[model samples]
Target chain A: MDTATVKKIAKYLHLAELEKREVPRITLQYPELSVEEAYEIQEHLVQIKLEHGHNIVGPKMGLTSQAKMKQMGVDEPIYGYVFDHMVKSGQEISLSDYIHPKVEAEIAFILGKDLEGTNVTIHQVLDATEYITPALEIIDSRYENFNFTLPDVIADNASSSGVLFGTLLQPPHKLELDLIGVTLLINGHTRDLGAGAAVLGHPAKSVAMLANMLGRRGLKLKAGQVILTGGITGAIQFEAKDTVSAKFAGIGSVDFVVKE
Target chain B: MHDLISEKAARFSAHLEQAELMGQGVEPLTSLDPQITIKEAYEVQLATIQKKLDTGRRVVGKKIGLTSIAMQKLLGVDQPDYGHLLDDMVVGNGETISFSRLLQPKVEGEIAFVLKRDLIGPNVSALDVILATDFVLPALEIVDSRVKDWQIKLQDTIADNASSGLFVLGGKPVKPTDIDLTQIGMVLYRNGEIMNTGVGAAALGNPAACVAWLANKLFEFGIILRAGEVILSGALSAAVNAEPGDHFSARLAHLGEVSVHFNPV
Candidate 1:
């Protein structure tokens, strides 16, 4: 939990991701990793990405589902950033570029106005949202076999790796935010299907919670930032020659092919 | 040639209207005329609806049917069909409806979109439907078939006005932007017991997509969905048979609940 320890763990996780290899869970070594400390480590890890010239595209939420929260024994969702280098679209993803990648379908929101405050309401989140679109997140956890404690995953940037977005964007006020349906397909077959309510009842609520969480640190979501709400469907593992596509009802589809 | 088509449409419409008025099921129009195309069916539907409008009843909105894959497969159709919602078809929530007024009634739970602006579309998208929507409400549609034994092909159902009957709307109105329409869960209770359950995605993926499809389909007929019209997107689940004395309630997540009671004969 000390500054030096946080930096060390941050570097360790960063190197694991960079080397495309899995490492032991951080909590396995520390045994007493606090959530606050885990986030501190995450900050340092993001700082490392920044130092490496990666731009912060926006933050993403993890464990936003009630089932996931209960499984993780957490009362709230976790946050991590998506770096500019991690934002991908319309491109083939090399399997060697990640440790072990899994894909999940999500709804992404682009903010039109700044949202700041501890009491940010879901309405405020909706009001500030400029566009909503379908998103596909490729999460590659650096922990061994994708296994990690909540703190371990938190410090690993919520297992954030890469994101691809659909081009279809509609204003938040023009959509039924909670009802957007998504079907995750791999190689043209349905793998998983879910709706926007999978993300904390409503996708907007996830953004609201994120905003309030950031507000605690005197941070705010600025205009034009893309926020990937948590996955609506469970993440499915993919391999070389697999094509992952997310089809969102009323929105559009986002897809990419995995290559060796 | 057009006159012959109009003549046939008028005759079929009158026959269907007569069956509806007498609360008696009639033979399918497709059985009467196997050559009846979807367009001709729509003309028949409009002719029948126009009769009601002439009788002082008003056009309340529109309804899309056969949206779910289950329903589409059941009807041997690959796409959805639609109908007009007349003012006379509005049933008050919780109101007991006389059994004599309905013939072979079946119930379906759906989300109703109340438009805030006119949607005249030759190219309406789901986003257009959402932006035009003011709010959405939970609804129960009592679908009755004029075609005997519920035997219907796409054309037969279209000619029968997509089996439009009576509908009850929930009181709670949530803004379209405020809720997720695709994932809203619905529980249909018949006689105080759960009969069916579904989510908004059952209707053409998202219910709003149903509305969008309806708007564009209507454009071919030169019909525009106007502001203040309540559009019943589509059924969230397969229709359940409605028996006399049955009390049916549909509880939609975030949108609230709507119910109707059939009068004991």
Candidate 2:
């Protein structure tokens, strides 16, 4: 994609998020959008967010689950950023901030040191992790009806929106990363459930892939940054006044309520 | 009631401090006073630590004891107890320590957190600990009970500063976020032979959580874990007895190794 087209799409998606309005997929207009071009658009969108005074919290992964990967027809996952403004916990989530949001359970890694290099392994990722905790990611695709192609989703920052972290912080070494069981509850009822293995066998693997991907662009995961390892369970749509919670075995639980 | 508590705390503190100064293990505080509460035990500990501070010994850090679930269960306690670390108690890595100075010393491998920010809490979370930590290092805590024969109950040990003795910190410092602390494997060697092996999870599932627990628990006592303090999370495995001429070294994966030698009598 040309610089002009990428900027146009980036501005369009930024407007979609800021204005709480949904638009058609970017691929619908630029069917030939390559993954690299999509990432370029994402970078531009991140730049726009920075210009608007939003600081980057860290990166997040998308389509890490086997089911999601299979459905998306991809062998790997996509990466995006989480802004500091998107972090919300211990407070009600106002629905006015989103167009149509869905919530999913996740394991978020907080780094103690910098993770860099193209050959970053899962072990390295684990080594760099200070701790892990249960997290709830609120994904609101700027694309209409949450429908989008791979490039379209990537360009939209993998629907990065809001994140709520659990109180429990555990060392990754102490956890059986692939076996952590999670239950997603909506309005006090179990809506969906999954395990940490859903995220590319182990959530750390998603982080490793993300680090290696960013390494290609000379970027790195910094210490004290929170990396949301993608959703473990399927995303469930939520609306105003709905209470959503995600409970992770041994890790603890995180919950939030939506308010209009 | 407050005066009685303070009186008992002062008496027990003097008793334990005398034993420490004389290099002799004394009777357990609980044995002397069966009615001693955990709260009172901590008061005794603070009193003794205050004595050390009066003598110009600075507070260096803190140590959490009985972090493992099994150890907690064995002691019939749901949580770990803490002790103060004095500046004089630090042994340099690879340095030889005098055996005659310690009574009934036992060594355990641990991860030490070096904080860069104050962790004041009633609600300090594990993430707060990680953020406040400047780095993590491999550590060897040489625990010694002022109580005779190490026959200590939870209160007894807590009153004796959780059996605080000497600690040796490794040189290689890594950020807490850089490695999976729960998975860090430890191989404790005594005189070049493996004595025990364990993982970071052995310390209350994750050592960082142990620190978090300590910070929150300390809030009740009006204590804040200040920056620059070295907080020993807890032992990762069973502590091995340290005898005269014994050389103990702990090899912690990723964090590196720390060792201390006991001088021959």
Candidate 3:
């Protein structure tokens, strides 16, 4: 696709999102474009948001799990865009604005320094992190006629939608590093549980990996920035009137009720 | 290029029809043209979606598929794939979803993350993942394929973005450092029966690691993890077949529980 065409598509995407109206039967017109190229346009569209004064937050990595890779039959991970508008407090999510919004439990890190380069290490992440917190991510896709492949989704910004954050917890540098547990509940019923080791052997290791990757790109984990560790538990579905909550063994709990 | 894509889509669609007529389980779709690599197919698909955008439908979010090792093996690949998630694809958490539009839909449990700042790649780590994240939430991925019976292969899926169909997210957020993500447990219940069980560790030996891996990988493509972007780490358990009128629920030991009801076609 030409740059002009890509930008045109991006503009249309922004228009659709801004209007919150569904476009009718788009597949017939773009039957020849491939999924990767679609993302290139989508990326351009997201960049437009940044150009338009919406702050570009951070990035989200999709297909991080091997299981997901096996299921989808791909070899690499996909990525997406994030913006300031999507951030929400643990208690601030309004059920009305979202369609099929779901949440997952995670650990978040706050950076104290810039981190970039391709050869960074876990220790570097540890040194760069200023604090840690419990969090939940709200994901909602905007595809009207939902159906896509890995490439198709990557172009869509890894299905990034919204996020909810919990209170700040003890810094990673001061914790015992073990014995931390997580519990998830729905409608006041205990549904799932797990320990901290479920994330890449240790959650900190994920930081190390991220640092290394960032280093390669002439980027660094900047001070005051945040990173969301992968889920503490698998995803759970939600229904209207159902209250969802996640509680850490030492940290506090976060909850939201479904609406509409 | 148009002719190539049209031809491929048509051929794959026909094979799927044949497979159904024979009552065979849908197998992976292969590129009859050996010259067409998965990467190339992905480019074509991207072009297709872009063309649509030129006309109308806007971009919404991205979807991560094939997050499990089993899926990788089944699809004859070693990594996960992704797909586009449109705004229209999203439904209320409790809303009933009709299976009529899906070729073969399945559900999986995952942990999703929201970014707080820009995360460019090269050497992103688990700790860095925490520092850059805004919050986390519980999620249920509804995977469907346009291909018949969801039988497309890895390359085909790569082109299709991993057969991501719909997603439902619970409304709540938590930080990455506050929870012990690795220790979290997950139970998948279908029709009130225990269908599957998993731990956060199942995702690349740890869910946080999965995010770290993704951060580093994105660096190769000159992409970065942006703040406010919601990222699904991948499925903790196997993708269970979802039928209409069937109810599915996944409960995280420490996070929370989520459920969805599917309506018949």
Best by DockQ: 3
DockQ of 1: 0.06
When sorted by DockQ, best at the front, the candidate numbers are 3, 1, 2
**Residue by residue across B1-265, what tens digits does model 1's lDDT show?**
1223488889999888778677788888988898889999988988887777778999899999999877787878888989999888999989999988888999998999999999988888988988999999999999999888888889988989899999999859999888678767666778876555567777887899999999888888778899999999999767999998999998777788899999989
The DockQ values of the predictions, listed in order, are 0.06, 0.02, 0.07
A119-231 per-residue lDDT for model 3 (tens digits): 66777877887887777766555456544555545555565677667775677876533234666778866565555444554566666666665555455566776676655
lDDT score for candidate 2 against the true structure: 0.88
Docking class of 3: incorrect
Worst 10 residues of 1 chain A by lDDT: A174-183
lDDT of 2 by residue, B14-60 (tens): 89977877888898888898999998899998888887787899999
On the 0 to 100 scale, the lDDT of residue A26 in model 2 is: 82
Q: Once superposed on the true structure, which residue ranges of model 2 sit more than 4 Å away at CA? A: A1-260, B1-5
Candidate 1: segments with Cα more than 4 A from true spot = B1-265
Model 2 chain A scores worst on lDDT over the 10 consecutive residues at: A189-198
Question: Could you give candidate 1's per-residue lDDT for residues A106-200 as a string of tens digits?
Answer: 99999989999999999999989889888899999999899988889999999999998888989888766665556777897666665666688
Q: What is the lDDT of candidate 1?
A: 0.87
Chain A accuracy of model 1 expressed as TM-score = 0.98
Question: Residue A229 lDDT in model 2?
Answer: 96
- Against the unseen true structure, what C-alpha lDDT does each candidate score? 0.87, 0.88, 0.65
